[model samples]
Target: MAKTYHHPKHDIHEDAGSMRADTKSRTTKFTSRHMAVYQAAAAFAKPPSRAWRLVWSAVLSIVTIASATVAFADALAVPEYVGSARCADCHKDAYETWNKSHHALAWTAPTAGHVLGDFNQSSFTHKGVTTRFFREGEEFIIETDGPDRELTKYPVAGVAGVAPLQQYLLETEPGRLQSFDVVWDVEERRWYHLYPEQELRGGDAFHWTGPYKNWNGRCAECHATGFEKNYSPVNRTYASSQAEIGVGCESCHGPGEAHIAWADPALSYDAEDWRGLSSVGLTMDFGKNTEADIQQCATCHARREPFLDGNPLPGAPFHDSYRLSTLRPGMYHADGQILEEVYVYGSFLQSKMYAEGVGCINCHEAHSADLKADGNGVCTQCHSSAGNPEFPSLRLAEYDSPAHHFHPAGSSGAQCKSCHMIERTYMGIDGRRDHSFRVPRPDLSVSLRTPNACSDCHSDRSPAWAADAVAQWYPDGRHTQFHFAQVLSPARLNPDNARDDLVDLAIYDGLPGIVRASAIDLLSEIGDPEIAERTSALLTDPDPLVRAAAVRLQRGAQGSVAIQNLLPLLDDPSQSVRIAAAREFLNIRAVRLPSSVSQKLDRARNEWQQSLVAKSDFPEAHIVIAGIALATRQFEAAVAAFEEVVTLDPQHIDAWTMIARIHAALGNRETAIRVLDDAIKANPQDISLSLLRTDMLP
Candidate 1:
């Protein structure tokens, strides 16, 4: 029999815990004792091995959640997780098919076959630093700058990724893995550093030995299955662990123990057993071919923040486990085009394809995770003249024909991806295609300063020149009339002037959630007292991302009113909303919460701290910690956190400025001047830093 995704025989719709209005009774039942148990378990479960402590904490959290959850389905009695090796017994075809694929080789122990880079004392130089790769006995070694800026020999601990680029993991300390800044370009067959233009010396955040490169904090969760990022804020240590070291069978399929039991021929099973728990012992229900299937792949593919204790299971709701980043500046262009290394999910969510039910599996294989076809073949599956009848809304067009594309056959200009999905090179070498799948609009590009596919290929032509060419082709202005970038661009630059435009964009439900959320975020810059009520009311928005943005916008409102409006969100079902509410509420110092409300505020505050602690290695996370400390007048703590930020990112002018201010606050004028001088040296090109230093002169 051909394999099929398992679904419950009956259609049963279940709301997420926080979204269900009826679950208020269940939430009310959760007492102080329950909260105490959670705290006690976290406190007392600290075994020497942080790995074991995480396991204990997870088990306790699950138990507490199970007892209190009324919005979730009945718990599936799944057994313990079994390794991927066991799946080969019955699924030989799948096991073998995936064996040699990139997903299977995504991570591997350093060996003769797995190691791609040359190790015959080959040396590569970039930004005034030369790293030598050579073999020492049975181990691969690289002689590079260590944490203290001295030449040191480090053995290759593990290898991450394959094909386009491969990065080697080096063990800087026991149980701490750091990715080498330099990567081996597999196709090019040369070592290239991510930051080739700028010198990333030791102690810099971008350096391989620094915190941003720490595998445990930054990369392990997605690379491994059943991974636990066991970070301790007190000791500033990591005791991370995983069930399997690569993206194994369980990584996408979830645990296999119960699936193994169901496969047994000797076992007496009923209809319910065949239906077999949550999507066949997996956490996600994929049979419906819904958005959840794409979300499973998105868990690793997107730039997002985890909303819970550990990595969420497969098939979980995207918002339930992770809070997706909106089309925020610095990450995306004003017109919602990919501008940074945002992966795919954030961009895909904005496309019409996703809205029309186009999923990852439609273009890619389920097991091997390879594209079903190469290049235009993947798109032509649904976009050909015949078209996919499944989606009748998509008008049939002979996309492969010369009449449609208007370029010579087999030319790069004629390719569908060239016009629809432009590629942006990130990490210096890897070219990631934008998944928004938008039509090339040089017209909008001219007005918004966004990149257009036409200009990408036509190097000599300007956006206006390309726009004129497009006008001759289309003749009609219909295609260029509708664009979110026009309003978004002005709103980003001056929200005060674009008040009506931003408000219109925020309330426009027809637009993508990310775009709407971004508009809401932009409204925070508006100082209009008239818009206060409008922004505050968005706290009740259905989308968690919108609510999150609304909480930030409400920060400028009257303190008592802001606290009252945000108090209810402290107990919101979504972790992102709760944390945002807590953070914003705490910022309003004038409004003191009553004891009844303070209890919930305290728990939410702890969640905010944990979120920052988990990402402690990041300079941005340290900045947040510093901001919180400074807000509460914890000068010493704030100074230390800001100093840590400066240590990680030497050229961080904002952190340097904060550090100088903290010293000045403590009545040390000389120390403040010294800090400014150091910042000026690190960021010589920064006129702001130079000006600030001149102001600090005695």
Candidate 2:
């Protein structure tokens, strides 16, 4: 007879931190339930501290464990930051390197020496509006349009960034720091507007004073140390604070107080003897030998949603603190090249290097965040003709030689990054490189309309020329197995014939969760009953991201089936999964749901609502709230929510579209036409709005 262990029942509740707290507690209890499995795999534990947790989980779950466990290091309570100045005393070499690095200068006070912008009454004109940069009694000032569209003089509060461009922060209200639209290009020694073509006026969301540009809510956390966006949703204000103005030593290494405590000459620093100290006297272990190293840097480098409502610890599990963005249409090109301002993480996750255990520090110095070597020197470190015995997968022969590159030695085309990592310009002047570390495939650029490194520099040549060059060099076809974009692009463009392929891709465990999630999300457009039915199995995918994406795909299924598919996910271990389930489940009418099922749905709905409220400071969050209200038939609430999105960002086209649709649904056809006309007036070039207006005309 087999024994069954019933998981402890958890009473779900409505609270800001209730769900996560409950999950942590429940998972802790789950460890005890696997006592038998724990003893069996005790010897397999590698790192004595972290191994016990994973061995028990892997043995009981009967799944191949991914080295490290997701278990939060419980040895430490909340870390307390000790300022960077305190660290300089013992670690002089690291301190000096960091002091001269980009991270240290990422943010700074507006001192004359620190201010790289020429504030000697310099002026820049954009769209007929002139912004004057001048100095006033030891203060840097910028005369620009205020929130009301009237010209106003505001004192520069701080400077952000250093080399290519430096953005100024202006205090529009007490404690409200808004990034100025006009920035100074240090290299060019000239003032320029970030949005040169668009006439973005005050009251618009993209305006400097708007939520998207607010330094406190949008950009401060990544730039500052121990920052907290103390947002009050009730009053719609921020009392943001930070331990330090710039990224400090503690920012990457976690809080230094515990480390300081253990570092004292009186205390024992031995790893074996420091069991009583918090996490062995370190808030985070940035051991480059461990998997957590890449994650530490990715905490801020990744384009992700901060699920936890505060600043995250340096080395915390990414899933606990952030919901990493997957390869979505607007965020990434169909061929998986970055299209928008998706920071490095999403692109790097798609790379063969990531799968081969390459991390940020492999090519970068941990302290300075600079490349270990210049140009091809970095590539030669691993791909040299001698070859790296450990990384046997590397095709390491004469990579830097002209014969391999088919370009003149020392030419721009011969550089490894020039061929593999294409540069995309963002913020008008800053050119960030794609870190996916992929082989150049100009063929995909032709078929999928995706940018390739080959085409980026070859302005006089075509992709066909580049593809032929690559074909001749390799002889065999470029590796397609690693190129997920080939299958994904077709699925997105023609889901009718590609539905079965997409379903297989979505549930395939061999691929990364991000790839699988992207496939599942694409299936959302397919209203085919067969695809919908087959996609139901993905609701229980081991990965939470896949499960969440599957919930969206099943939204078009029959009401009863959709509800059934989503019900179990309400109790998912991951809050993001539960939230996705709850929102999708509520899309169906509650009147049709069985009494018992409705009760569960209500619980899930409340949880979802609370999660949305937690991120209410964001315009996107309000849009999601509006969508929920519209789906649940709360017409007035939906209208109010949509209106709030416009209030937050006047140029939010989606809000205007939803508002018009609601009015039309409520039989106010004239009002719908008026709304569309207004949106079209604001954005004349928006073809979709123009088409919608023409369709709405009586």
Candidate 3:
């Protein structure tokens, strides 16, 4: 009998979050003279004589130069979306599906119909602290103990979601920024004070008005469309805005204007493939394409940083810009069960399915967020009973019954995922199941003391008993060794003695790239003279990742030999290796180099600067460059970079504080005072800013 596949059905009729009705009230005021100059420059750029072109170019350059001089200057104005009404005209099916999915209703407007929680004067206590949730006319209000036991009334700006915990948003800086308070009770269905013990001790991180209150920098990037945090560190304020309130049609499709023009039937989008286009509508063959695009989505969704923002340039690889979480300590347990806060993407990469080219879209439908097919149906798509002709040894029949599972047919224990994939809850209620999909190995579990599927089910039973049961079921079965399990023990126990073993593991070709990279990281901690020499030779390794690791581990080594070996890797094909080389070289400031090598290093630095120019709105990039400039004693460059950072992201209090220090160092006391005044206006309730101002006054 053929096994039937079961697809999980997901409701796709949910509403996308709330609309920002208050956006029209806030307007950015630019200087009249600057606007006039910009208009004149725009007019001069039109088709004209050679003399006129020269005049236009010069004027535009002047305008560009002047615009950077002024603080809080708005360049690109984001267009507002009317609503989902426009999208429904062309894509009715997709719109309907999105409405049903959780993406639509992730955040919602407060109303009698839409509001889920009990907001009518309710007090809830958690961890020995009390918080009251009440209503101020139509708006929801939360009253919690502020600094010195003072009761503070915070208005709920918006609701996060319906199920789980209904998180409330607080407007810390009115229109400019809003932040989510950390505490919410799922069982009592009420709001509670977060970090109650710390609050009682008078040292709470989430005291009403803190650095975390700048929601635009902390949260808006992931939630809204084209979000620019627009924080001014010098001013200590946020002037953040987005193109859209929630994820809209343009989020995935790129800008819709070009797409709309192409879709018109009158004008052929492509002259060559008109008939082919009519026959087959827009369909992307995800299976045929390389994993680059899929990896781009994974970059943000999987807990990685932005190397470049908006649209990444072609051939710019993922790992070059972002540092992925390795299977390191605190992230995973001894036998690879997730222990700390992992965002799934790292763990998923470890699976055999991912290595076999199975992507996120294979299991998950794009629009609906539902499983493409149910249960065994998804697994059998590639693994058929007829047998995989590519790998004939994968006979499906041997693994299809109670004999293999050692459990009765139709039982919960018989299900494949039940024994293999374990579910872990995060953020109190969000249950995420592991996707690594490894079979239960109780024998290894006993040796390593990692949790096994049998012990997970039979909580009272020991690993020894589980191993004996597995042996009884398959008497001749061999316990396969995990490479990580093998290397981890010696690496942790005797770091000094394990140098050679770690280096060998780092260069091992057959081992997984993640494991190899991890071994390299471990070796960096206790690497001696011999290991450093071995790592120096690896600067010429074919793989960029290994070569990059080699550069990182050999940072502190002196002498001309080490510096000469690393200079050539500055132009490596992989940006990761080049950046690594740059950082390593920058560390050894006094090391003399050949003029040509110095020139190559300068060229690499310019490339990094150019990359930053392309994504000027990214605050993190500015901060990194500013740190680099400060270290090099380029005080002017450092000040400029930090100023740009503050303008791009106002909620950066640390940046503002640093800018004031820089001004004071430069003997510009007036400028420092003005910067503080701006910061105080942005966050008037910030006690730290108040204290800083008092200290600076004298």
Candidate 4:
């Protein structure tokens, strides 16, 4: 019989700092790749030390570099820091400020020092069910659902900071994973689960051990340092690993090896050293030289997907590996004012600050997670009382007072962020605000029936009432007239009725590019020839995002004429648009292009070739382009593409399967069999690959 361990469900009070110190110091040695599986467990089980421990460890290791080098070589090991201690050494002011910021304590151990909630025996009710929070000895625990219908007790490993809702953590199995459940009333000193009533009453959608519970799949990458979620979906088990527990020094600074090398005074630092070590030493500068790096941070913080891994480096091309949120039905209102949890990255992308090359670091200090200057001071960096000639309305004295805001001077309502950057809560207690920096569009709220800032505070009032109030206060308010009224009008009726409006909106340059791109989607309901032709033109739009959107709309069109019109976009300058265009034109036969159009396509393809010349090291790009070639029946090109994919990402199962298929199609039976055999060697558990190999043996 398997030994089952039961955890007590109650609050555990202890010294969190000591606990974290122990966890960080305790290191485990393993003999195989399977050793990676126990890394998270080892990290979590030890106690944490002060930030100085990590700094001293790094310093000591550096001092005895020759001896440490032999030890590291023998173990194939890397050093782990508690957090950004080495960075703090150089950046004292920033480090001191960061110690007070939320990011430093984003995740902490459960103790009187870190745990801010009332954990004494208290019961709370929600949705007709009651749950209790109590202390059991020195450990925190929760009584919740097990695998079946049983109510079981589990240990609460951590607390999610001080807020209206504090969350508790539970370790499900040793060397496996930890889970989180909601806790309410951090300040009130009362404990209640986030959805205690619903969960206890059997109506909760997010239960323990659900799809969302597996932290490796859902949240580990973002929360922990150097996390590699080795989840085997078939086994339904996680073998996750990380360099360190919690977000540590290496999380943002790539790997520390090169930085360590450059930091040595004996070594002669060069240009490469400067480029690589730039992320170290700290300042408020985020070092987002390329659009991709800026957007890479945004992808995790923003709502996006991982299209491919290790292809485009962080800050290369966002769309190459991720698909950004567009104006979708549930995610946004028809006017795109962010109805759902779109996250800050996408919303910020649409802001004037982003357009002006003002990145996350311009306002936020990276290590400290605090503003570089106070609210008014930061705003005044660009906007002054003397007035910016480019932006005349940005006068500080005029815009700073209650006369312009129509609120009390020191009131919460008067803060620029409170009114413009309305907060949305995620994971029970984390309140994230939109960074779009848009004005209050009460008129749009009335038209689309979406929530506005005025009505959020004044819940009983209508949007029209709020609009009228704003109009009265600022007699010349621009938001009084809705810019997206026409788009919302047709969206209100039916998708079919708004087909023409949608098609027209796609190409309308006057509107925000995102808004127009969203409008093009409304045409999906209509099965007309004209709508297809209109969407085809968007394939050449100046914005790569718009062009990509057009390619998607065109693919759905299914008409031969539409396919022909989209073929030219296959060689688009933007890799995102080109990838989409290539995928769209896959099934269509090549049509004769006009000499001028052919020349344009050739030029675009040349641009794409130049871009790829340097990025040839990446396999996913080859795989994607190869898939396009395969779809177009260019078998040789497909084979070459698949070969590159397999070479770069040896773990890629799809590339191996395609290689087998391409070989079998060419009547190279032995080679096809060998290809599948190699795939099985890489991933022996892949039943599909095994079956395909067996079926191929003639």
In terms of lDDT, model 1 sits at: 0.71
Candidate 4 to native Cα RMSD, angstroms: 15.4
Q: How does model 3 score by TM-score?
A: 0.68
Summarize candidate 1's per-residue lDDT along 151-210 as a digit string, tens digits.
899999999989789999999988889988888999989888877777767756667877
Q: What is the TM-score of each predicted model, taking all chains together? A: 0.84, 0.81, 0.68, 0.64
Q: State residue 160's C-alpha deviation in candidate 1, in Å.
A: 1.0
Candidate 1 vs candidate 2, lDDT winner: 1
**Model 4 TM-score?**
0.64
Candidate 4, run of 10 with poorest lDDT: 14-23
* Segments of candidate 1 deviating more than 4 angstroms: 1-79, 265-279, 307-310, 589-599, 670-698
lDDT of 2 by residue, 243-298 (tens): 88889998877767668767788754554433223454664666634457877787
Q: Which runs of model 4 end up more than 4 angstroms from their true locations?
A: 1-83, 109-113, 117-139, 157-165, 173-178, 196-205, 267-293, 308-316, 372-381, 387-397, 424-431, 480-482, 509-511, 525-529, 540-544, 556-698
Off by over 4 Å in 2: 1-77, 265-278, 288-290, 389-392, 479-483, 527-529, 536-543, 556-573, 588-607, 660-698
Sorting all predicted structures by TM-score, with the top scorer first, yields 1, 2, 3, 4
The backbone clash count of each candidate, in order, is 1, 0, 26, 22
Check candidate 1 and list the clashing pairs: 284-315
